[model samples]
Target: MLLNQFLVLGAALFAFGVYGLLVRRNVVLILLSVELMLNAVNINLIAFESYLVSAQAVGQVFAIFVITVAAAEVGIGLAIVLMIFRNRKSANVDDLSLMRW
Candidate 1:
Protein backbone atom coordinates (compact mmCIF):
# COMPACT_ATOMS: atom_id res chain seq x y z
CA MET A 1 0.00 0.00 0.00
CA LEU A 2 2.66 2.45 1.05
CA LEU A 3 4.88 1.52 -1.86
CA ASN A 4 2.12 2.22 -4.34
CA GLN A 5 1.46 5.57 -2.71
CA PHE A 6 5.09 6.57 -2.94
CA LEU A 7 5.23 5.49 -6.57
CA VAL A 8 2.19 7.56 -7.43
CA LEU A 9 3.59 10.61 -5.67
CA GLY A 10 6.90 10.24 -7.43
CA ALA A 11 5.16 9.97 -10.77
CA ALA A 12 3.13 13.06 -10.05
CA LEU A 13 6.22 15.04 -9.20
CA PHE A 14 7.96 13.91 -12.36
CA ALA A 15 4.95 14.88 -14.44
CA PHE A 16 4.70 18.31 -12.89
CA GLY A 17 8.38 18.91 -13.36
CA VAL A 18 8.15 18.02 -17.04
CA TYR A 19 5.16 20.30 -17.48
CA GLY A 20 6.97 23.15 -15.78
CA LEU A 21 10.01 22.63 -17.96
CA LEU A 22 7.91 22.84 -21.12
CA VAL A 23 5.86 25.81 -19.93
CA ARG A 24 8.57 27.98 -18.38
CA ARG A 25 10.62 30.36 -20.49
CA ASN A 26 13.50 31.16 -18.19
CA VAL A 27 16.66 29.11 -18.68
CA VAL A 28 17.49 28.98 -14.99
CA LEU A 29 13.98 27.93 -14.08
CA ILE A 30 14.00 25.26 -16.76
CA LEU A 31 17.19 23.80 -15.33
CA LEU A 32 15.62 23.75 -11.88
CA SER A 33 12.58 21.96 -13.21
CA VAL A 34 14.80 19.40 -14.91
CA GLU A 35 16.49 18.78 -11.61
CA LEU A 36 13.12 18.22 -10.01
CA MET A 37 12.19 15.65 -12.64
CA LEU A 38 15.47 13.83 -12.21
CA ASN A 39 15.01 13.76 -8.44
CA ALA A 40 11.51 12.40 -8.77
CA VAL A 41 12.81 9.65 -11.06
CA ASN A 42 15.54 8.87 -8.58
CA ILE A 43 13.00 8.59 -5.79
CA ASN A 44 10.97 6.10 -7.80
CA LEU A 45 14.04 4.01 -8.68
CA ILE A 46 15.26 3.85 -5.08
CA ALA A 47 11.85 3.14 -3.68
CA PHE A 48 11.22 0.27 -6.06
CA GLU A 49 14.65 -1.21 -5.38
CA SER A 50 14.21 -1.07 -1.64
CA TYR A 51 10.78 -2.58 -1.71
CA LEU A 52 11.10 -5.25 -4.38
CA VAL A 53 14.51 -6.74 -3.84
CA SER A 54 17.30 -7.31 -1.38
CA ALA A 55 20.03 -5.86 -3.54
CA GLN A 56 20.09 -2.15 -2.77
CA ALA A 57 23.24 -1.20 -4.63
CA VAL A 58 21.84 -1.10 -8.17
CA GLY A 59 19.31 1.61 -7.54
CA GLN A 60 21.89 3.58 -5.57
CA VAL A 61 24.30 3.29 -8.48
CA PHE A 62 21.71 4.54 -10.95
CA ALA A 63 20.73 7.37 -8.65
CA ILE A 64 24.37 8.42 -8.44
CA PHE A 65 24.58 8.34 -12.22
CA VAL A 66 21.48 10.46 -12.48
CA ILE A 67 22.93 12.99 -10.08
CA THR A 68 26.19 13.11 -11.96
CA VAL A 69 24.41 13.54 -15.26
CA ALA A 70 22.16 16.24 -13.84
CA ALA A 71 25.15 18.16 -12.52
CA ALA A 72 26.94 17.97 -15.86
CA GLU A 73 23.77 18.98 -17.68
CA VAL A 74 23.35 22.01 -15.43
CA GLY A 75 26.97 23.05 -15.87
CA ILE A 76 26.73 22.86 -19.65
CA GLY A 77 23.35 24.59 -19.68
CA LEU A 78 24.59 27.45 -17.48
CA ALA A 79 27.65 27.94 -19.65
CA ILE A 80 25.47 28.12 -22.76
CA VAL A 81 23.06 30.53 -21.09
CA LEU A 82 25.91 32.77 -20.06
CA MET A 83 27.37 32.68 -23.53
CA ILE A 84 24.00 33.47 -25.07
CA PHE A 85 23.40 36.29 -22.64
CA ARG A 86 26.78 37.74 -23.46
CA ASN A 87 26.11 37.63 -27.17
CA ARG A 88 22.50 38.86 -27.08
CA LYS A 89 22.47 40.91 -23.85
CA SER A 90 19.37 39.11 -22.64
CA ALA A 91 18.18 35.73 -21.33
CA ASN A 92 14.57 35.82 -22.36
CA VAL A 93 13.42 33.20 -24.87
CA ASP A 94 11.52 35.81 -26.83
CA ASP A 95 14.81 37.63 -27.33
CA LEU A 96 16.13 34.46 -28.97
CA SER A 97 13.53 34.72 -31.68
CA LEU A 98 16.09 36.75 -33.59
CA MET A 99 18.18 33.61 -33.95
CA ARG A 100 15.25 31.70 -35.46
CA TRP A 101 14.61 34.17 -38.25
Candidate 2:
Protein backbone atom coordinates (compact mmCIF):
# COMPACT_ATOMS: atom_id res chain seq x y z
CA MET A 1 0.00 0.00 0.00
CA LEU A 2 2.88 2.35 0.76
CA LEU A 3 5.43 3.68 -1.70
CA ASN A 4 8.27 2.07 0.18
CA GLN A 5 6.57 -1.29 0.06
CA PHE A 6 6.12 -1.07 -3.68
CA LEU A 7 9.76 -0.08 -4.07
CA VAL A 8 10.91 -2.99 -1.95
CA LEU A 9 8.87 -5.39 -4.02
CA GLY A 10 10.30 -3.93 -7.20
CA ALA A 11 13.82 -4.20 -5.84
CA ALA A 12 13.30 -7.81 -4.89
CA LEU A 13 11.88 -8.65 -8.29
CA PHE A 14 14.77 -6.90 -10.01
CA ALA A 15 17.28 -8.77 -7.89
CA PHE A 16 15.71 -12.10 -8.77
CA GLY A 17 15.66 -11.16 -12.43
CA VAL A 18 19.34 -10.20 -12.34
CA TYR A 19 20.24 -13.46 -10.65
CA GLY A 20 18.24 -15.45 -13.17
CA LEU A 21 19.82 -13.60 -16.07
CA LEU A 22 23.29 -14.37 -14.83
CA VAL A 23 22.68 -17.98 -13.86
CA ARG A 24 20.31 -19.31 -16.51
CA ARG A 25 21.80 -20.91 -19.58
CA ASN A 26 18.66 -21.36 -21.64
CA VAL A 27 17.57 -18.60 -24.01
CA VAL A 28 13.91 -18.85 -22.93
CA LEU A 29 14.79 -18.43 -19.29
CA ILE A 30 16.93 -15.41 -20.15
CA LEU A 31 13.98 -13.87 -21.96
CA LEU A 32 11.73 -14.52 -18.97
CA SER A 33 14.28 -12.89 -16.71
CA VAL A 34 14.30 -9.82 -18.93
CA GLU A 35 10.52 -9.72 -18.74
CA LEU A 36 10.71 -9.92 -14.97
CA MET A 37 13.10 -6.98 -14.91
CA LEU A 38 10.79 -4.98 -17.09
CA ASN A 39 7.85 -5.79 -14.84
CA ALA A 40 9.84 -4.59 -11.84
CA VAL A 41 10.49 -1.31 -13.62
CA ASN A 42 6.78 -0.99 -14.36
CA ILE A 43 5.97 -1.48 -10.69
CA ASN A 44 8.42 1.26 -9.71
CA LEU A 45 7.10 3.64 -12.32
CA ILE A 46 3.45 3.17 -11.36
CA ALA A 47 4.24 3.53 -7.68
CA PHE A 48 6.17 6.75 -8.21
CA GLU A 49 3.50 8.21 -10.41
CA SER A 50 0.74 7.40 -7.99
CA TYR A 51 2.58 8.69 -4.90
CA LEU A 52 4.85 11.50 -6.12
CA VAL A 53 2.79 12.96 -8.92
CA SER A 54 -0.80 11.99 -8.60
CA ALA A 55 -2.03 14.60 -11.02
CA GLN A 56 0.17 13.55 -13.91
CA ALA A 57 -0.13 10.27 -15.79
CA VAL A 58 3.36 10.36 -17.27
CA GLY A 59 4.57 7.40 -15.25
CA GLN A 60 1.57 5.33 -16.25
CA VAL A 61 2.12 6.27 -19.87
CA PHE A 62 5.77 5.36 -19.62
CA ALA A 63 4.86 2.05 -18.00
CA ILE A 64 2.50 1.33 -20.89
CA PHE A 65 5.28 2.10 -23.35
CA VAL A 66 7.59 -0.20 -21.49
CA ILE A 67 4.98 -2.94 -21.66
CA THR A 68 4.62 -2.44 -25.38
CA VAL A 69 8.36 -2.61 -25.86
CA ALA A 70 8.57 -5.69 -23.69
CA ALA A 71 5.95 -7.43 -25.80
CA ALA A 72 7.84 -6.59 -28.99
CA GLU A 73 11.09 -7.73 -27.42
CA VAL A 74 9.56 -11.06 -26.41
CA GLY A 75 8.26 -11.61 -29.92
CA ILE A 76 11.58 -10.85 -31.54
CA GLY A 77 13.59 -12.67 -28.90
CA LEU A 78 11.51 -15.82 -29.27
CA ALA A 79 11.85 -15.66 -33.03
CA ILE A 80 15.61 -15.39 -32.72
CA VAL A 81 15.67 -18.22 -30.20
CA LEU A 82 13.67 -20.41 -32.54
CA MET A 83 16.05 -19.65 -35.36
CA ILE A 84 19.05 -20.40 -33.16
CA PHE A 85 17.52 -23.68 -32.06
CA ARG A 86 16.88 -24.64 -35.64
CA ASN A 87 20.38 -23.82 -36.81
CA ARG A 88 22.44 -24.88 -33.79
CA LYS A 89 20.22 -27.63 -32.35
CA SER A 90 20.39 -25.98 -28.95
CA ALA A 91 19.07 -22.84 -27.26
CA ASN A 92 21.71 -22.40 -24.61
CA VAL A 93 23.57 -19.12 -24.27
CA ASP A 94 26.94 -20.84 -24.76
CA ASP A 95 25.83 -22.19 -28.08
CA LEU A 96 25.17 -18.65 -29.30
CA SER A 97 28.86 -17.87 -29.02
CA LEU A 98 29.60 -20.57 -31.53
CA MET A 99 27.86 -18.41 -34.10
CA ARG A 100 30.83 -16.05 -34.06
CA TRP A 101 33.08 -18.80 -35.29
Candidate 3:
Protein backbone atom coordinates (compact mmCIF):
# COMPACT_ATOMS: atom_id res chain seq x y z
CA MET A 1 0.00 0.00 0.00
CA LEU A 2 2.85 2.35 0.80
CA LEU A 3 4.83 4.14 -1.92
CA ASN A 4 8.11 3.02 -0.39
CA GLN A 5 7.04 -0.58 -0.64
CA PHE A 6 6.27 -0.24 -4.32
CA LEU A 7 9.54 1.56 -4.91
CA VAL A 8 11.47 -1.14 -3.15
CA LEU A 9 9.75 -3.87 -5.10
CA GLY A 10 10.41 -2.07 -8.36
CA ALA A 11 14.06 -1.60 -7.43
CA ALA A 12 14.43 -5.25 -6.55
CA LEU A 13 12.83 -6.37 -9.79
CA PHE A 14 15.06 -4.01 -11.76
CA ALA A 15 18.16 -5.29 -9.98
CA PHE A 16 17.27 -8.89 -10.69
CA GLY A 17 16.59 -8.06 -14.33
CA VAL A 18 19.96 -6.33 -14.62
CA TYR A 19 21.68 -9.29 -13.06
CA GLY A 20 19.99 -11.67 -15.47
CA LEU A 21 20.85 -9.50 -18.43
CA LEU A 22 24.50 -9.31 -17.47
CA VAL A 23 24.98 -12.93 -16.44
CA ARG A 24 22.87 -14.88 -18.90
CA ARG A 25 24.38 -16.48 -21.98
CA ASN A 26 21.18 -17.34 -23.82
CA VAL A 27 19.63 -14.71 -26.07
CA VAL A 28 16.13 -15.65 -25.03
CA LEU A 29 17.02 -15.24 -21.39
CA ILE A 30 18.47 -11.84 -22.11
CA LEU A 31 15.25 -10.82 -23.83
CA LEU A 32 13.26 -12.06 -20.87
CA SER A 33 15.48 -10.05 -18.59
CA VAL A 34 14.78 -6.95 -20.63
CA GLU A 35 11.07 -7.62 -20.29
CA LEU A 36 11.50 -7.96 -16.57
CA MET A 37 13.21 -4.62 -16.41
CA LEU A 38 10.40 -3.05 -18.40
CA ASN A 39 7.82 -4.57 -16.10
CA ALA A 40 9.65 -3.10 -13.13
CA VAL A 41 9.47 0.29 -14.76
CA ASN A 42 5.74 -0.19 -15.35
CA ILE A 43 5.27 -1.04 -11.71
CA ASN A 44 7.02 2.15 -10.66
CA LEU A 45 5.03 4.25 -13.08
CA ILE A 46 1.70 2.91 -11.85
CA ALA A 47 2.82 3.25 -8.27
CA PHE A 48 3.74 6.88 -8.80
CA GLU A 49 0.50 7.52 -10.60
CA SER A 50 -1.49 6.10 -7.76
CA TYR A 51 0.52 7.93 -5.15
CA LEU A 52 0.43 11.32 -6.84
CA VAL A 53 -3.31 11.20 -7.53
CA SER A 54 -3.08 13.11 -10.80
CA ALA A 55 -6.22 13.83 -12.77
CA GLN A 56 -4.70 13.01 -16.15
CA ALA A 57 -3.24 9.59 -15.26
CA VAL A 58 0.02 10.43 -16.99
CA GLY A 59 1.97 7.61 -15.42
CA GLN A 60 -0.46 4.98 -16.60
CA VAL A 61 -0.47 6.49 -20.08
CA PHE A 62 3.29 6.45 -20.22
CA ALA A 63 3.34 2.89 -18.97
CA ILE A 64 0.98 1.93 -21.79
CA PHE A 65 3.33 3.53 -24.30
CA VAL A 66 6.24 1.66 -22.76
CA ILE A 67 4.30 -1.59 -22.99
CA THR A 68 3.58 -0.94 -26.64
CA VAL A 69 7.21 -0.22 -27.39
CA ALA A 70 8.36 -3.22 -25.44
CA ALA A 71 6.00 -5.45 -27.39
CA ALA A 72 7.39 -4.17 -30.66
CA GLU A 73 10.92 -4.61 -29.35
CA VAL A 74 10.30 -8.20 -28.37
CA GLY A 75 8.77 -8.95 -31.73
CA ILE A 76 11.74 -7.56 -33.63
CA GLY A 77 14.27 -9.02 -31.21
CA LEU A 78 12.84 -12.51 -31.40
CA ALA A 79 12.67 -12.35 -35.17
CA ILE A 80 16.35 -11.50 -35.30
CA VAL A 81 17.18 -14.14 -32.75
CA LEU A 82 15.25 -16.71 -34.72
CA MET A 83 17.15 -15.83 -37.87
CA ILE A 84 20.46 -16.00 -36.03
CA PHE A 85 19.59 -19.36 -34.55
CA ARG A 86 18.61 -20.69 -37.93
CA ASN A 87 21.89 -19.62 -39.46
CA ARG A 88 24.24 -20.54 -36.58
CA LYS A 89 22.29 -23.43 -34.97
CA SER A 90 22.80 -21.84 -31.55
CA ALA A 91 21.25 -19.10 -29.45
CA ASN A 92 24.08 -18.27 -27.12
CA VAL A 93 25.15 -14.67 -27.08
CA ASP A 94 28.82 -15.55 -26.91
CA ASP A 95 28.56 -17.42 -30.18
CA LEU A 96 27.26 -14.42 -32.11
CA SER A 97 29.80 -12.68 -34.33
CA LEU A 98 27.74 -11.66 -37.29
CA MET A 99 28.71 -8.03 -36.90
CA ARG A 100 32.43 -8.62 -37.10
CA TRP A 101 34.33 -8.15 -40.34
lDDT tens digits, residue span 1-101, model 2: 78999999999999999999999999999999999999999999999998978666999999999999999999999999999899899999987785485
lDDT of 1 by residue, 17-63 (tens): 99989998888888889999999999988888788765657887888
What number of clashing residue pairs does each candidate have, in the order they appear? 0, 0, 0
For candidate 3, write residues 1-101 as lDDT tens digits. Answer: 79999999999999999999999999999999999999999999999999997899999999999999999999999999999999999999989977878
Question: Alpha carbon lDDT of residue 16, candidate 1?
Answer: 91
lDDT of each: 0.88, 0.95, 0.97
Cα-lDDT of candidate 1: 0.88
Q: Tell me each candidate's TM-score.
A: 0.89, 0.92, 0.94
Clashing pairs in 1: none
Candidate 2 — what's its lDDT?
A: 0.95
Cα shift from native, residue 1, model 2 (Å): 3.3
